[model samples]
Target: MLKPVAAIAALAMIAACGGSGADESTPPEVTAAPAATPAPVAASTPAPAPVAVAPGEPSPEFASLPAPYNAANYAIGKRTFKLCQSCHLTAEGAGNLVGPNLHGLFGREVGSLPGFAYSDALTNADFIWEPHHLDEWLTNPRAYLPGNRMSFAGVRKPADRDALIAYLMLETGYTSAEGDAPNE
Candidate 1:
């Protein structure tokens, strides 16, 4: 009776250790706890920086327009603006679509859309949408305004852009076909 009691006591002691010590040859069942944390080492390097603006105010991509309005150039601007009309409205206070109202937009301050949210791309983009600035944007809107939501491929031809910009200036009352200020 004493020997049996001793064997039972030894078995209880082995179980208390949390490791099964039934026999020297018997394998113990140990459940590993799940690793709840990730390693501290960074798996990948950060992404490259963005290239958007010039060093100073809109690095003179387009020199301010020369004195005389080039009829020929304005014609080109008119045609170029047709492409812009697809995304932008040409009427004053028109409804917003992909972009804001462009009527009287030439001299308007940037990011003043009544209800539309402009991309940071447009607000920070130096230079008003003047004839010269529009020319560059129509040339390549994506490059001109990186991260701009408008997905225009941009007009490639200078003559075409000039015609379109001329029209925009005239329509927006920013300049005349002769490059004079619009008649008040």
Candidate 2:
């Protein structure tokens, strides 16, 4: 009785995983070892497929991702940063409180805010905070770049995130390629 049910379920899984999508061409591994008395159930479930991301690159955002990291966006970022004003400051090289000063975020290492007690999650991170990375991080923050110290859920507005990154780009002195634009 149990063998009949298990056989039906195994057939279903084989059919489902036998797709030519992302996992196409990959051979399936046998998890349930063949047994003398005919085992009751599939011992272990097949591992779920990995999510596909573009190779060797970060996901792009904004137009040109607003690179040269626009001055307008930086100014806009300052204003949007007002949302953070209660807890943060954006001068030259500041520190943290409810949050950090955010003085030099761009080009800076992730989770590398000086003097601030950072989470173990960020301190070990290997990625640099760049315009593209910042956009991604600010997009969903916790989801985008997990392990960040920020407790505030995150800003949902893309424009606001853009502005904030632009402002940080200016502070970090990651000079933009945009012509004739004085960084804010």
Candidate 3:
């Protein structure tokens, strides 16, 4: 009885692996072992260097703002960023959490912040942290880099990504001097 069950199981495994088509004369093919499954984008990876800010850094409260800075989309983005809060910190002096602090995130090199030990994939990334790149990354992090270690499934909606980036630009290490207008 056990022998019959084992035979059935083996047959099922072969069928699942697509083994039914070959002829008796054909030689068996060898394939490489599969690589590890990529982690989700929302998950945190390691960063090496020690940060200046403490884990729970305090920031000053701001009064009401004017115009584009206070746009509705920006508000939406702030809400969207809540999804990222578990891994990253937005306060000016906040230290690293599961991921790095996002205080002055834009215009900086990817994975270049000192004190955080970054995975080789991120540390070797050549691009700077611009809006477009951020969009691609947020769309699907595992697709972006198959083996880097972020684990949260990415945000699929374009609108959500847009709002989140807008918020990050405004709230994370933004200076009043760098107004919303593009630099000539």
Candidate 4:
């Protein structure tokens, strides 16, 4: 009885100190609390820094465009493109976002990309994409084609429209053929 009471008091002391009452020589039970091991530190690799383009120098992406569209206007277009980035992707194999991926857009028929779901107005329209048509469409999408689904309020400035069209031409891989002239 006295030995059992002594064991109980030892357990009480161990419990107060947040320890198991088992002797140090005794092996811990399978259910015993595990000894804490420090979490392994993850080896972080730094992300590659963005390539900086010099002022007045055209970026490699815009280098192939004609003189006026290649340098200063390309820069403006690139800046303006930020507004469209939320919906569109210009890379050739990139997946569609809110709008369809715009690679090979210049000669493509309106709403003709295979996987994208276009509105009935676009799907039924007979026009191919061209700079002037794009300009009018960007001027006011809703007014240009009533019942179309683009939510942009339209680029009001003609210069901005020009820049944006030139940027899209370069980014979407337009190559000049006989009929593929920029709007004067």
Candidate 1 per-residue lDDT over residues 1-184, each given as its tens digit: 8999999998899788865745657666799999889769888999644323422222121234432233335434544567677778877667877888778766566667678898898777655445556666677878977888878888876556554655565455464333233222
lDDT of each: 0.60, 0.61, 0.68, 0.79
Q: For all candidates, what are the clash counts? A: 12, 3, 13, 0
Q: How does model 1 fare in lDDT?
A: 0.60
In model 3, where is the ten-residue run with the lowest total lDDT?
A: 54-63
* C-alpha positional error of residue 170 in candidate 3 after TM-score superposition, expressed in Å: 0.9
The alpha-carbon lDDT assigned to residue 122 of candidate 1 equals: 73
Candidates ranked by lDDT: 4, 3, 2, 1
Better of 2 and 4 by lDDT: 4
Q: Comparing candidate 3 with candidate 4, which one achieves the higher TM-score?
A: 4
lDDT per residue for candidate 3 within 86-157, as digits (tens), equals: 999988878998888888887778989888888888987887776666777898988886666788788887
**Residue 113 displacement in candidate 2 (angstroms):** 2.8
**What lDDT tens digits, residue by residue, belong to model 2 across residues 1-184?**
9999998898888788874345656667769866669559888999744333343222222124344444234345556777777877667765566876667665577777778777777788787666776666666668875777676667787666656765555544554432223234
- 2 against 3, candidate with superior lDDT: 3
| lDDT per residue as tens, model 4, 91-154 | 9999899898989988889989999999998999888887767878989999998889899998
Assess candidate 3 and give its TM-score to the true structure: 0.55
Model 4 per-residue lDDT at 177: 47
